[model samples]
Target: MSPIIENFEKSVNTLLLVSTLVATVTFAGAFTVPGGYNSPGKGFYIFVICDSIAMYSSIIAAVALIWAQLGDVTLLLDALHLAVPFLGVALSMMSMTFTAGLFLAVNKLR
Candidate 1:
């Protein structure tokens, strides 16, 4: 393989590695929700929902990463293009998490 192909493979491998870590972390977080939900407030529910979305999005990202590693350049490009929506889902989940955190903080002071 050429130097450029080698470099691209390395970059793809790194992306897969980081994506795996993110999936692991987000999936772990799904089990460790904030406030324990003993009272089941709206914020807690939102947190759980966000965590679920993040977990699923991370799962899709992992699939996409694997997809990207397989097949030729055209296939890789198609797989990575699919990953963009998963990326957006992950980003929205992060934003939801922040909003949930703020909601929790405010409720705590109430």
Candidate 2:
């Protein structure tokens, strides 16, 4: 195979792994909400929104990267282009979710 295709495969694999991990973490976050569900607040709501965004974006990224795994060069390039931004969004939203969750938890402790 060409070097370009080899590189694409490696990148796709790495991105797929990252997207999967982000989705998994965010999915888990949804269940064990900070400060519990009994006392809903702005921070809690933010956490939920951000977590959902992160999860969905990562899932989308994973799907796109999967498309890249198909043996077409043009399709691989297009899918890689699409997946990268979604992965970035997912990572950013995951950070926001963590921050919001931390804020909620800390406020609860205080």
Candidate 3:
């Protein structure tokens, strides 16, 4: 591969590693923090669930990227594997919005 392609692959792999570490740390923090889930706000729950899913997805994508690199998968397959985490992020944002609305509705009812 050309120097440019090699550099790009290195950068992508580094990003995947960093993202996986961050997700792991965040998940650990969620467990360690007190009152992490006691809030009356639905947004908190939504965020927690979203974060959990996003973290797992990121970890999966990172592993998939490593597999692709080792197994000489097609570039398109590698790209698709890398792109999955962004979808998780998008879904997390949607969950945040829906959770906020749900909390507001519940509060109004009470």
Candidate 4:
């Protein structure tokens, strides 16, 4: 295989591993915390479910990216599959980070 392909495979593998670990940790944390999702409140469970879905989708996307990098399919097809969940993960992470940062900034200003 070409050096470029080898490097791409390595990078995709690394990303897949990292994303899988992060997803696992996030899911575990969400489940372990009391009232994290089990609270008798509005939308708590829904939020937890959505977070879980996002994390899982990220992991799946990472796996697909790695598989594509390993030369499983045409480059275009692989890219298309990878792009969908890559965007999903990116959007989810950015939204969560921005929300947390905004909350912290507002709290500090108060």
Instruction: List model 2 lDDT by residue over 1-110, tens digit each.
Output: 99978988999999999999999999999999988998678898899999999999999999999988888999999999999999999999999999999998899463
Q: Candidate 4, 49: how far from true, in Å?
A: 3.1
Q: For candidate 1, lDDT tens digit of each residue in 48-91?
A: 78867876786787688687787577766676677657866876
TM-score of every candidate = 0.75, 0.96, 0.58, 0.57
RMSD of 2: 0.8
Pairs of residues clashing in candidate 2 = none
Please identify which of the two predictions, 1 or 2, would achieve the higher TM-score against the true structure.
2
List the candidate 3 regions with Cα displacement exceeding 4 Å: 71-81, 84-110
TM-score of candidate 1 to 2 decimals:
0.75
Query: Best-fitting candidate, measured by lDDT?
Result: 2
Q: Number of backbone collisions per candidate, in order?
A: 0, 0, 0, 0
Candidate 3 residue lDDT tens string, 1-110: 76766765775677667657656655664464323355646466665665566666666666665665663537635654564565456346444534544564465464
Candidate 2 CA-lDDT value: 0.95
Q: Give the TM-score comparing model 3 with the true structure, all chains together.
A: 0.58
| Candidate 3 colliding pairs | none
